[model samples]
Target: MTPPANAPTFLAQHGWEGAEIQPLAGDASFRRYFRVLSEGRRAVLMDAPPPHEDPRPFVAVAEWLAQAGLSAPRILARDLERGLLLLDDLGDSRLRETLDIAPEREIELYEIAVDLLVHLHRQPPMSGLRPHGLDQWLDEVSLFPDWYCPAVGLDVDGAGFRDAWTAVLRPVANDGRAPVTVLRDFHAENIMLVDGRAGVEHFGLLDFQDAVAGHAAYDLASVLEDARRDVTPSVERAMLKRYKEAAGEGERFEAAYWALAAQRNTRILGVFTRLWKRDNKPHYTNFQPRMWGLLERNLAHPALGPVRDWFDRHLSAEHRAAAWAQAA
Candidate 1:
């Protein structure tokens, strides 16, 4: 794809005139990224067009992560009004790509990724971040009924679904444990394996513009129980054990981990379906089976009784398969 009309002016103003700009792979969000090469140096230009997307939150969070000694992209320059940012080129070695080439490194890579989260969780609560608690979880999961159910011809009782989620998620929202900065999309695709970096810094974080002050377990679940790729049960189990031991949270951590996993996967089901039905991005549906499997695994936990019952009553086996089959 061609760069935006103003991209040349933007680059020229930043002393990158005549730079080679090539489109980089985009994520599920509206933001677009480009790799820029000028003067034998490389940088990434983020084109977060206005109205649909904003760059300020990303700027703030990037600063926060940098201050915390994490490997977030350095903001070389920015034009928030124009929704554009020139950032340090973190390179093309995403954990996903690296793992695809060297599956043997999955455990090693995930340990580093988990250690990064463990480090973040130990830090004091971040200021200026929104809470990703009960209300947020409910609002996200509602997308399933709002978009997916209708698209799959399943008549859903939206109020009932919300109530069910509320019952299960209320304790989580009210839990006394202090919230930490949750990088809302901490998955393999969003993590770059930086060479020559030490410890957790070896993992370059991305797509964290939506970071929130939420339960630590949310990001953990986002990583281990990813929607875009299959993280083997053994790896998931090992990572969970590593996190629990490293954070020293014990059984409480286990409960929160499964609960958040259920919530995240539930929300993804709707989000993916919405991408297909509303955004015309049907490829997202391809992950429905994996999402459903993760949801089921989490819902099996006794703590998720209400949510399990809710699914049992509202989403019959056939109804569930209807959505899955659509993707297949």
Candidate 2:
């Protein structure tokens, strides 16, 4: 697509000039980005809908990250009203695309990612970036009945799962809490490898607009418990072990890790459902097994026994159908 005549005008007003433009490969979300290759300067241009994908959160998070000295993409220009963002080019070096590299190299690069997560998690709280908190979590978890119920086509049940979720969270929410920035999507796909070597310190981070003050283990789960790609158990274990050594497990680390993981995984399930029923894209339904894995993992946690019991009864049909339907 040719750059709009007004597009150059917008860039020129912002002190960017004379650039050759090409579209950068996009991700699963509604946002799209392009590479603006200029004279000895390259930038990424992001296009997002105002209602669905605002750049305000992304802008705030990027500024905070820059101040903290992280290797994230810097914002070059933005049209907040239009939700268009111009960013530094981090290159086409996603960890997901290059994962076939040797295991040793993979582990090395992952360690660097862990280090970055540690840095963000260690930062002090800033307003407007915290988790949607208990209220949002409650609402989010409640959606299970709305979507998972229909998908499974199961006999009706009361709000038993919600009661269990609250009962389990009451003590943890009261007793232990640590706050820090959490990049909700910190998987390999968003990371840019600088050095060809795996596990090196040189890398650029991207897609951190959703950063929020959250539990310390949230981003770690984002990396280790990745959705789009797989992280071998051995590697995930190593990454967690490294995080534990570096940060010293915060209060109820494992509990929080699994809790936030459940939250994240549920949010993804709803998103996938919306993608199919509302957005007309059904490929996301292919992630049925992975979504079930997340649900089961949360269930297996001892504290989540009540939640697990409900899922065991309700999710069985959905699980079986999801598997067999996709296979067919």
- What TM-score does each of the candidates earn? 0.97, 0.87
lDDT of 1 by residue, 96-161 (tens): 889889999989989998999999988886798998888888988888888878977888788988
Highest-scoring model, TM-score: 1
Residue-level lDDT of model 2, residues 62-146, one tens digit each, is 7777777676677878888877788877787778777766555778778888887777667786568757466666677666566
Candidate 2 worst ten-residue window by lDDT: 319-328
Model 1 residue-pair collision total? 0
CA lDDT, candidate 2, residue 220 = 86
